[model samples]
Target chain A: MEYMIKNKNEQLTNWVNEYSDKLYSWAFYKTSKKEVAEDLVQETFLSAFKSFDNFKFESQPQTWLFKILNNKIIDYYRLLARNIEQVTDDEFLSKKTTDALFNNSGQWVSAPINSQWEEQEHLLDNVDFTTVLTNCIKKLPQNWRIAIESKYQEEKKATDICKELDITSSNYWQMIHRAKLQLKICIEKNWIIK
Target chain B: MRFFKLSCKKATEMVEKEKINGLSFIDKLRLKLHLSVCKACRGYEKQSTLIDDFFLKTSASDIDNIKIEENPKLKETIINRLDNES
Candidate 1:
């Protein structure tokens, strides 16, 4: 048993030497942050080492390492998404901007702005529009941002996000709804008019 | 009239909810009824769906093309940590 553990450690050490750079490059590419990418790569290797026993070697070691790194990236975002300290329940419930969408009788207070988005082809291909969209996403409240991120980036189910964030399903959908409304307003303000 | 009437606020909420969890028969019918008369909610639905598609496309396309130089010390740091763990 001691000899086997030593062999495993040696194998992992060799992998660390060979693949760490590639893993770091991929992590940096995904996150676009230096410290976060380095931390994620470190965590990925640590996790890979801890679970070395389960690695069947059916796949290339590099493949296995990249897979582990991908999961670590997901977990990093999940952690960020869960950091909702700046967003409070009251703020979630009473966002004045979204509230301003409707009137006392629950009708639209003003006509929903006619979006020219449909007229534009391949809007995402336009770097300026993407930059604007990215900024708008950043401007969302943390919880709302998580809701959008989990839905789009992680492709997670609504129930799973609610379960992860410990929010009710109603709250989850509401966050998404308000997020879209705000994004629409922001995009219209920044992209269309500008 | 009251039974078929759904508030624009409620109609928009149902529209978003439908994307995640499909609405029930009554809620769906009410939303349909409200939307038939309300052009603004219809516009909201279209714009909201467009935003969702943009998010989906952005996530799919954005990250893979990034290029970066790898950190030299990462391997050393990882090796040191592994040594401590064992």
Candidate 2:
């Protein structure tokens, strides 16, 4: 038992030495601040080390690290906006999104801007996507982040996220409203080719 | 062009609730009009989505500049600590 602990400690340190920089960069994508990202990455490693004994190797270690990092990012946001006033009150299920990005009216309640796409739109050429995305997400209002993460990551229904956040169905829609606009503004400001 | 000529804020709400019924008929007509001419809006929509897609792609392998500090002394320090603990 003692020998196993010693070996595990050595392995854990090895993992950090090899993975810290990469983990740090990934964290930067979420926080958009170097210091905050580094702190989260280091904390991720520390947490992993503390719980090394329970790691059953069912999945890759990176997967494990990411789950921890995701939780940490959410926690950071929760702290950043603790004083915010929420308007929604539903407990579970979202007000919409049962259909898809496009709704049934086919009229699009929130019409997506349709434009002619160029050939280069699909290119993912080892670009610094992380930096670009992190900068954009950071500019998002706290409500936008809350809405996107709940819908996209947590897979919670809109109603439920609204309930948990104390926002209304209307407020929930409004938050998404503002978020998409900001995202469009951010993209125009940062990504479009001249 | 998409229907739902929602305002930036209203558009975002529409997108969030994933709703389609609340938009005015004129709103839909205008969105279609805009999409027909704007290349940039198309790009903007793609970018809006990348925020979510990026999260899924950014596993540990997506990290950059990860290299172990190759100092022999660090290895020796570990060995010493191991020796002492035993």
Scored against the true structure, residue A184 in model 1 reaches a CA lDDT of 74
Best by lDDT: 1
**Per-residue lDDT of candidate 2, residues A1-194 (tens digit):** 98887787777667666655556666665566777876676667667766877777887787787778777876665554344345333211222331233445433334333322223454344365346556776656555565655444344443554555553456556555555555544444565442
lDDT of 2 at A82: 41
Docking level of model 1: medium
lDDT of 1 by residue, B1-41 (tens): 78888888888988998887778898888888888988778
Model 1 TM: 0.80
Computed on C-alphas against the true complex, the DockQ of each candidate is: 0.58, 0.14
- The models' CA-based lDDT, in order, is 0.77, 0.53
Off by over 4 Å in 1: A1-7, A17-38, A73-94, A112-116, A155-166, B62-64
lDDT of 1 by residue, A146-165 (tens): 66766764666555655665
Write out fnat for all predictions, comma-separated: 0.65, 0.14
Question: Candidate 2: where are CA atoms >4 Å away?
Answer: A81-170, A182-194, B1-12, B19-86
Q: What is candidate 1's CA lDDT for residue A154?
A: 60
